[model samples]
Target: MAGLFGSATLGIGGGTLSDLFRAQYRGKAVAIYSWSPILAPLVGAVLGGFISQNTTWRWTFYASSLLSIVIQLSGLIFLEVTYPPLLLRRKKARQAKATGADDLYTEYDHLDEGRVQVLSTNLFRPFKLLATQPIIQILALYNAYFYGNIYILYANYIDLWTNVYGEFIEIAGLNYIAIAIGSSIAAECCTLINYAIFRKLSSRNGGTGVPEFRVPIMLPATLFFK
Candidate 1:
């Protein structure tokens, strides 16, 4: 259930960062944001191993639920509305209530053209990109393969160690820590490198930045070597 919702809305955080940050800093901000979802599962697996070995499997879920509650509470208290369209809509709503005006609207209100249109647009967007953009299709396929490998590893990793290598389950899970550490270091490097390259490219284009400027750094990073 968590995986279903997480995968469905994974793009929302990136979209939110795009709304909050300027173009020059947006890529770097999103890189930092992207690291969390990728790191969480890896780190969780390591913790799950120790918890499962010492306690029951149910305790692993209990720990997860407790941590999720903490995170949601923190977000409720500290997270502010950052998306401009949504912020404007919220402001308009408050003004309408206070002024007794039912006709108040925001610039983005045109987008609320019934639930059906909005749902269709959102649902078809990825397919539209895949249809029109060859690069997007290639990237999608590549990521599909890459994540497939990671999922397979997660399923068989402890079994391989505990059965073949005769390692304790707690020790077997420690291997995921190495992957988590490596990915963290890489994300930091990529964020800095991506920002630096974006700055240099934007400067060359008569002080105007193009989205294409992001592609060079992105391509190498896609290869996971940058």
Candidate 2:
């Protein structure tokens, strides 16, 4: 359930950033946003092992709960409604209240009664793309393979280091630093390459972005991985 909620939050956050950012910066912003998930487990395993060994396993839950509370509070305090339709609807309501008129309505408020069906379709649209979109299918396949191996390694690292190397659990955890370092370097390199490709492609397209602009770089990168 925790992983499910966390993944859902990440998906929603990515969607929100897509809406919030301009086309040119969206790729870079998303790259940076996505770095956390790749990097966190590498860092967390070391720290979590250290804490669990020195203190108690319960502290992990406490720490996670505290961190969640802090983030939730910060979001509640610092974030504002960024969706344009929602903001406009709120403004319309305020205006109506002040002017004593019921006529004010945002475009969303005027949407058809069948909008519930439209919303349901929108919710299922991602699943539809997952099933049918070849590009999405390919990328999802690669991501699943890559992260699956990383997580498999994450789970078994302790056994590998402990039984094989006769290292303490905390010391065994230090092996995760190698994964963290490699991930950081790859992320930085990808960010730079992505930025360079996006700029060049945007210029070549006369400043209008084409989704295909991002594909060329990936081909070489994937081949290099091969």
lDDT of 2: 0.81
Could you list the CA RMSD of all candidates, in the order they appear? 3.1, 2.9
TM-score of model 1 relative to the true fold? Answer: 0.80
156-208 in candidate 2: lDDT tens per residue?
97889989989988899999999888877888788678877888889988998
Pairs in clash, predicted candidate 1? none
**Considering every candidate listed, which one attains the maximal TM-score?**
2
Locate the minimum summed-lDDT window of 10 residues in model 2.
Answer: 106-115
TM-score, per-candidate, Cα-based: 0.80, 0.82
Candidate 1 ranges with C-alpha deviation above 4 Å:
96-105, 131-133, 218-226
